[model samples]
Target: MYELRDKDFIFIFTGPNGAGRKTVAQMSGETLGMKQVISYTTRAPRSAEFNGQDYHFVSRDVFTEAERNNEFIEVIEIDGNRYGVKERDVAQMIEKHGAIYLVLNRFGAEALKKLYGNKAVRIFIYADLKTIVKREEDRGDTPELIQRYTSHYDEEMAYKDQCEHIFENLDLAHTVFDLTKTLDDNYLHRNLVDKD
Candidate 1:
C-alpha cells in the first residue's frame, strides 16, 4: 500500500466499459473541481461521439507512431481497437487543474499508478454483467463489439482488487457519495498533517 500524496493530485476511475466509470467521474468532477483527460482511440466513434471531445480519434499508423515515441503513458488494445491516455493531455490537465480525474481502463490505471505511485488515487467501479450488457446496448455498441467486450469482461473486473478502492455502481447517488467521502477523508487527513 502507498501513502497518500502530500498535495492534491489525480483520481483515477477505471473498469470495464458500461461500469458507470465515466458518469461517476463527471459527477465527481463537478463536485471536486477536477478536469478530465480525454483519451485517444483508434476505434471508430459512435454516432453521437465527437472527435477530441469524446476521444481523439486517430488512425492506427498515427497511434503506433505516438506509442513508439512514448507519447502515451498507457496503451491497451480492446478487440483490435487501440485506446490510450496521452502523456501530453494528462500533463496539460494537471497543469491547469490542481487535481484531475480520469476515466480509463485497467491497463491505463495501472500505468498511472506506476508513474505516480501514491500520488494517484485509483478507484475501480463495477456492476452486474446484466447491467453492463444493457448499458452497452443502450449506448449502441454493435453486437460484435459487445461480444468482444463481454468476452473479456471478467478479466477486466478481476483487476478491481488491485486498485486502492473499489465501488459497485449499483446506485449512482450512493457511488457518488461514497467516492466524495473517500476523497474528503483523504484530503482532510492530509490537511491535518499539514497543520501538524
Candidate 2:
C-alpha cells in the first residue's frame, strides 16, 4: 500500500537491554548516511554516554517547555523518567533531503508508523538470547543489565516478529554483511522471501 522507495526509510529499533542495538544503530548511522538523533532524557548519564554524544541531557523544565511547544515526534515517561524525540527533528531532514531515519524503541516505532503513515519503515535487529547474554559479559554488564534485559525480554522478541523486517546479529561479520545487503536494490525481495 505504501508507494515509497527505500530512500524513505526510518529505522525503528527495539531490544532487550543488551541486544547490541546501539552497535547496529551506529553502523547504520555511519554507512547509511543516517544521523542518529540524540534523545532528550532526564536520566543521568551512564559511563558509556558522554554529554551531548549519547543524548541531550535536560532538566525537567526544558523538556516540559519543548513538549508544550509540540516539538516531539514521540514522548513517553518510563520508570518515572521522561524521554522525547522532537518531530521537527525528523521533519528537518525530510523537508530538505526527502528522507529521514529514526532509531527508537518498540513503542516509539509503532507511534512513528502511525504518525508517518506510509513514510515509515521498521527494521528490528535481534540476536539469540544466549548471544545477547554473552555480549553483555563482553561489555561488562552488571546485575543492572541483567535486570533490565530480563524485564523487556518478551517485548523485545515480539518486536522482531511484528516488524516489517528483522535481522539476526549473532555473528558480527554476518550481521554487517546482512545489513549491507539490506541497503541494496535487491533487499526488498529478500524481505519478501524471508516472509515466505
Candidate 3:
C-alpha cells in the first residue's frame, strides 16, 4: 500500500449535508497555511457570502470565458449555475508542497480520482440524520431550506460510498483529532497497529 504522508498527499472529503467536509477543509486549510481555491459561480450571492472570499461571484459570461481559457482545474454546472476551481490556485499551492486538497461534490471528486489515480486520499464524512438537522439548523438555515436539504439527504449519503475512508463528524475538535491520529500513524490505516 502507498504510504500516506502529511505532505505530498491530497485528501478528498465527501459526505452528505451536515457531514462536515467543509468544516474539515476550513480547519485543514488553517492548519496547513493553505489558501482555499474559493470557487467561482454564477449563482446570486447569499446574504452572508462575500465576494472573493467565500466564493468569487461572476457573471455567467465571465465564468464561461474563464472556462474556455482553460483556467479552471475543474468546473461543473450544478443547479443551473456554473462552479469551478481555477487551475492557477491549485497549481500555486501544489507547486510549493504536494499537500493540497479540494473539497468537492460527488461529480468533481469522482472525475479527479479517475484522472489522477491513487495520488489522492478519499475521506468520506458522514453523520446520522438527526445530526444533519441540527447541523443545518446551527448554520441558521431556515425551516424550509432545512426541510429541502433533509429531503435530499439520500443523495448526499450516496457520495460516501465512493470513498476509501469514512469519518463520522461530530464536532471540529473530534474531526481534527481523528486526522491528527492518522498523521501519527504515518498515514497508514490503523489496522496495522493494535488499539485497545
Please report the candidate that would top lDDT against the real structure. Answer: 1
Full-model lDDT, candidate 3: 0.70
Q: Write the per-residue lDDT of candidate 3 for residues 31-150, one digit (tens) a residue.
A: 544455567889888666789876789999999999999887678876688888776765576667556677777766776576556766677778899988987888899988788657
Q: Pick the candidate with the highest TM-score.
A: 1
Question: For every model shown, what is its TM-score relative to the native structure?
Answer: 0.85, 0.82, 0.79
Candidate 2 lDDT tens digits, 128-184: 777777777776868676666567767768777767767777766567557646754
What is the lDDT, from 0 to 100, of the residue 128 in candidate 1?
83
Give per-residue lDDT, candidate 3, residue 156: 70
- Tens digits of per-residue lDDT, candidate 1, 37-128, equal 89999999877778977788999999999999988888888778999988887777776666888888888888898988777878898998
Where does candidate 3 stray beyond 4 Å? 1-7, 32-35, 183-196
Better of 1 and 3 by lDDT: 1
* Cα shift from native, residue 90, model 1 (Å): 1.6
Candidate 1 local lDDT, residue 87: 80
lDDT of each: 0.81, 0.69, 0.70
How well does candidate 3 score on lDDT at residue 48?
Answer: 65
**How many pairs of residues collide in model 2?**
2
The TM-score-based order of candidates, best leading, equals: 1, 2, 3
Q: CA shift at 180, candidate 1, in angstroms?
A: 1.7
Q: Which consecutive 10 residues in model 3 have the weakest lDDT in total? A: 187-196
